[model samples]
Target: MDTKDNHSLPSDDTTRLADTNSPTTANPAETTGSTTDPASTTSPTYTGITEEFNTEDIQVVQVGSVLKNRFVLEEMLGRGGMGVVYKAQDMRKVEAMDRDPYIAVKVLSKDFQANPDSFIALQRETKKAQQLAHPNIVTVYDFDRDGPNVFMTMELLQGEPLDHLIRRIRPSALPAQEALSIIEQMSRALAYAHSENIVHSDFKPGNVFLTSKNVVKVVDFGIARAAKDSDRVVEDATIFDPGSLGALTPTYASCEMLEYGTPDPRDDVYGLAVVAYELLAGSHPFSRKPATYARDLGMKAERPKEISKEVWQAISHGLEFERDKRTINATQFLQEMSGPRSGRDSRFPSWAYPVTAAAGLLMAVALVTLMFFGNGDGQPEIVLEETSSLAEEQRTRIEDLLEVAEVHGLVGRYIEPSGSSAYDAYQQVLALHENNKQAWEGLHSLGDQMVVAIQKLLDDGKQDQAEILIARGLEKLPQHEGLQALRESF
Candidate 1:
């Protein structure tokens, strides 16, 4: 099986599953040859083009029919475990009235539709996905089942899959901070779903999307289950092998997910973090395969630190196979994300920090002079000194900037071919205080030479990517007069 095969679901004998193939432009005249024709000597009178953008030149393939009413299907956009996606259009609107360009339609296979369990999964996804309205999640507009056929309609996203992106960039080779930010955004989406009692059981790179606008959308909730629901057991659910269909990527799956067989918030954390580790360190934290593959490898694997000490620690606690050792929940995870790499300055006050610092100070004081006051006499003085460090003005500012830089750099790290003010600001901060421990750490955390590295990946084409990078820079360092001016120039 090609790892890149988007659709991995098994095909039953009764149902017809189309092999995902690129769209073939059979009827260019239908798409390009319109009623409005200019004085062109060309035989095929096409529409919507001068000499620059010609729809006739592009090949268009029909994938599936839409609404069974207006739209005719085009080429495949992607294929996954469940359905196949294709660029489609409303023939009524396009050929006749000449309206919107295209839309995406996801069609279920005959085999999948025949399985009652698949039908239930489809219904559950549609209901939950319909309720989710966010920029980071794929929008579900309308869903319909025409006889045995089931399909979903959505905005056409002209972009590359995140799976290819990771492979292209080789995320494991990226900087920790960059890797962490991608995970953070993904976490934010997962957190939202978890709040609604949703579990994206099939959370993976293929399910994540990046639009031209740098907008991230977590997609393919088709197979996702509600957190409280039990895994569906359909005797006929074996479009694939019965035992293997339930399996998720073991590299990312939590122990509890395998044992309890329930969807938990920690499951998402583990899976997403696995992606994070891969993006940051350029490899999976666990060298072992999912279930069956684990037997050959040792039960325990090398830690993230084996790649880099900074990442090892950043990902260490999160990668704990045991749920308890991991971040308690997304809320706590965000709370831990409070400082620089958090994309915020430490100057921002949180009750947790002051409280922890105070407690630490008090503990130090008590330990120093148990006898000085005999019974907590000099404790107050000692505690004051210990906690006072957090209160220092210079130290606080440095820490805060470090935090902001960290977070901004995290964002910047993923900005392909980056040369943004955010990237520059992060770089400047590091350069300004080379010896400053906080700055150095932040710089180390920033991770990835993406701005420069991505150039090599895309044949040195950085126009669109640079624009995004510039926008990202402006987002973090709005006060940067130069960046502010550049944003206006664009």
Candidate 2:
């Protein structure tokens, strides 16, 4: 079923799948018109669009309608060709029982429901998606049929689709850091799904949801194909299941998908690359036409000046037409973009260097002694060493703790003070060495930095942001004087 528009569908006896024959638009977000605004009288409209389903033929569920005596439909979030998505409250579960009492319901349209084959295909595909449980992927709770209506309950998210975000911030792409952050989360999600042998055939911006908390979630895995059954086809009478109707955005479809009607992990990698390219350059990699294996009919994407060389190279590699030549997988793409992690560098505070250096020197001396002064038994002559082995071990432990503490301090300084990096690191150091003044000082310093950040937020009249920062800081460092003072101020 073509549930392309992110909407809920109603039940009907028609055989046609929802939105399957709808005209494709240049903009992916245009597939589904802007969601209905409950507060506004005017409905959102899109240009160059033709919906296949006739609104007059289907019975639209009204607001406040209760489904299965459990989900109370509240507002229409979006509508796609195959379904309508609604923000509903789970009356059976209280807020205390369920952290999120609100849920998203994707109800199939009447036309889609009328086609038994399409309904079965959707059910089978959604069942497969249930196996994918990860922090970066939207959580699919349950799928059920209430009388004529078929719907799936998923985590209700407050965020804009990536396509909408791109459209809203066009001409200027997302900041480099923000784009990378989103990509990192997306890669992890794809990697996890790939590990489970699931390949998202339709990985595109429209399917990526970025939450208010800056978390990137990959949705619509319901149409994903299993890697082990690459050639498997769904024989739905109503739809041509070119690997689940090959329901993919043409702009992001990989060469394999276009050429052979098959997809693998590389297809997803290619899609992610296209997304990264668009985010960095504020345009598609191919300007004139969508990319195809048989022809390179468009201008090649030029590297954005704002993006770093390493990141651009990674993105370019991922955009390769040949599957074998593309970035091998999502994990590799992320590694290339993020670069390799090495030992702590100059960013580490000055005081941290002395402890690290001393620890290294001690280890070096110990190693040299072991090599040159081996006893007859082949073990190092501990008795002849300048310092006791126990002393050396203690120094090494202290060094390790200090290194961790330094890393935490740096993370807190640069990323976010509310993060447990500095606080947890300091606590570990104190546990090992109670007299470690640096750890204590670092903890207090982090608290002080957090207070400064909160104050700045308040000064800028971002009271909500400041309160969130203060709450996070206090949660981590309840005893910190600066955090305590900041809490009082709030």
Candidate 3:
């Protein structure tokens, strides 16, 4: 759970879902007094939003409505989405006397409940999304229903959406370096999802959020997007499309998505590029036109003078009208832009360093030789310190750290709980002794455990979850044959 909570709460084992607000789930009462206007002047001017979802018969949910005696709908969070999002109060948490009982809930219309299978599909995707623990992705908690209304709950974030930011910064580009940072964060989130065979078919500025802390979080993972799984029969029964919920933003949607073609990572790559361009130029590449329309009209985006040739080329590649000619995925897009930065750097790998952190060059060189001195009961102990560089105190510290690492490994705390997991403990050892064979081997062993765990997901027919774990493992052990093999097998 790589969370930066709205109440300044710390991230825990499970990232609590929270956010300031997006235009669709727009206007948290704490921030503004304005009611939702889909035709709001600030929103992107895209016309492809046909009333395909037929929301005119939209069910009205009052602010004070209570559902199933569990959650109390308190405020209308926003109205620009396929459904209404609310800042709700959890009766269970309130009953428990919990300090933070408020949660963000997105309530789907009657169409969702019309076909129970669609609810099942949404639940399955929500489950897959909960495992996406990256800092830059929104954390979904669970999905449930209250009579005919279906809703999903997540952490309550207190910040502005990326679309708002882009609107606020219009007429001028975001500083080159600053835009790079935003692009990298977006890519990291997309890359993590792509690794799990998941594609955010609908990627747009509205879905991208920027917390008050200035951290980027891409929202709406699986709620109302086209499924890429060829075997899935979730959407076959309903002609009632999720796109009516505004899942697919035509301006940001790729040519393939607009044509109802096969889903691919390149679709997201194209969307990412559109958002990235907006960050740089503060405007849509094709003036808010859908990909197919823009391509047919022979419209080409003019590179902003502020961006460099290298960066513009990367952004342009993603804007290609054809999937084959477009950027392959977010990873390649990030690399093409300006390479990895800080926590998301691929060079450090998530196995040795935590995926949510950049624990780079922190390993100490541990050159250990254990021997028994005088009071020996047959247990090997560190007793020799050959030089000042290998001080007795340093040796003792290394031994203590190694012991801690070994203990964490045995209990299966490989790369969690942040700084205290086996990976972190082992990293601490290496920071003290870079040449420590025990620490390196320990990291590899942890990688092996990850492989075994992912295999279990695959065996259980949880391919999406398994792929996500494999991506995380490869980050730490890119060269680990087992992890690599799992990736190629996918």
Candidate 4:
């Protein structure tokens, strides 16, 4: 099996079975072509999706169908393990004269609804998703019912999911920096959710979305469960656990998840590692084998040739078969990748050095630290020192500019408005503090964001717009190799 299989465990002995694949198989939100929209070119429906849904569902989900008279299903974007996501126009938004009257609505599948606990599962999913407010997590509106059908509304994304992008680039790896940025964003989201005592339970490329603005948004917390150590008070007294439904994509699931062990943050770490590996190496580390099966076979991941030792260590740590051996938590994984690479290079243990040399090295380090932290009194007093030696005024100015750049970035103002754009502000901050960390990161992030937007415009046949943006980007950062290469491709 290509690990394309997804299973659902029944409450009874093969009696009360819940089959999720057929309902969650095809995605309507990911569909670029549409049957109802006369403007969009028609693409073949995703395999086994529409066919499995009974005639009744087909009729219920027909194009132009009105759900609760508030949402109009105009086009199908994708159908997946959770349910069918449609590019729906919120009639309420239209009535309110909203500029972007669109939203992505995921209609629950019949099989999922057929589960005796389906209603409660969906209610939990909606509440859990609403609690996650990070920028990287999708904003879920509300769960509602129109007769027998139930659906959840979310922000309509403009770009393809990570899985689709991986398929397009496969057999060849993504640039190291691009892959790292995507992974970093993913880690941040997972870390945030873990902090809230939530486990994604299903973290796969299919569940990750990269918006046109280059923001990475993680979706589908349908199977999310409270962590084993969660101190959060349970408002709902339901005894049913949604994860018992077992709707996970096997390839990306950790062994602990597969065995139905207690939920842990490390489970997400394992999935993150798998997705991270695929992003950089362009293939699953275990060749699409389930984690348990791979571990039984003693399979080991091969390091990609282009990756640095430090980066590979971080990735490899997350890929560890045992949770104890893994990177400990998502935040540690992110820090390993995002922190300075001072210890990135492989080196022998200090004990490996001659005794005298090792002692001398320790003495030298201690003397340097003492000199740097000399409290003027004859006795030592613990005084925290700023890492940067820049004067307070200079530091304040840099901080102000960096803050301005961040606000601009959040609103997608990467390079417009000339001197006031994120790019220009980052440049100013860098000018004030040559090695300002936020300024450098902002520039790189802005470059990535602009490239994604520019590519989407180019793909849509809006070459004039793409070219204009490209020219503006080059004017700001002419030496940026990513932009330079994009311009040269034309």
Highest TM-score among the candidates is held by which one?
4
Report the poorest 10 consecutive residues by lDDT, candidate 1: 30-39
Candidate 2: worst-modelled 10 consecutive residues by lDDT: 38-47
lDDT of 3: 0.64
Off by over 4 Å in 1: 1-66, 91-101, 175-178, 226-247, 291-311, 337-490
So what's the TM-score on candidate 4? 0.61
Candidate closer to the true structure by TM-score (higher is better), 1 or 4: 4
- TM-score against truth, every candidate: 0.55, 0.61, 0.59, 0.61
Give candidate 3 regions above 4 Å deviation.
1-60, 226-238, 340-490
lDDT of 4 at 198: 75
Which ten-residue region of model 4 has the weakest summed lDDT?
Answer: 33-42
Cα lDDT tens digits, model 1, 200-295, are: 765666567655444456875545452113134633222332113222444455666545466677777767766766776676566534522343
Better candidate number, 3 or 4, judged by TM-score:
4
Candidate 2 deviation (Cα RMSD): 13.6
Task: List lDDT for all candidates, in order.
Answer: 0.48, 0.60, 0.64, 0.64
lDDT by residue (tens digit), candidate 3, 175-229:
7655665677788789889988888887876677766655567888876452333
Of the pair 2 and 3, which is ahead by TM-score?
Answer: 2
RMSD of each: 17.8, 13.6, 16.3, 14.6
RMSD, model 4, all Cα superposed?
14.6
lDDT of 1: 0.48
Instruction: Score residue 66 of candidate 4 by CA lDDT.
Output: 88
lDDT of 4 by residue, 202-278 (tens): 78776787766666789876544522112123333112223323345567778887676777889899999999999
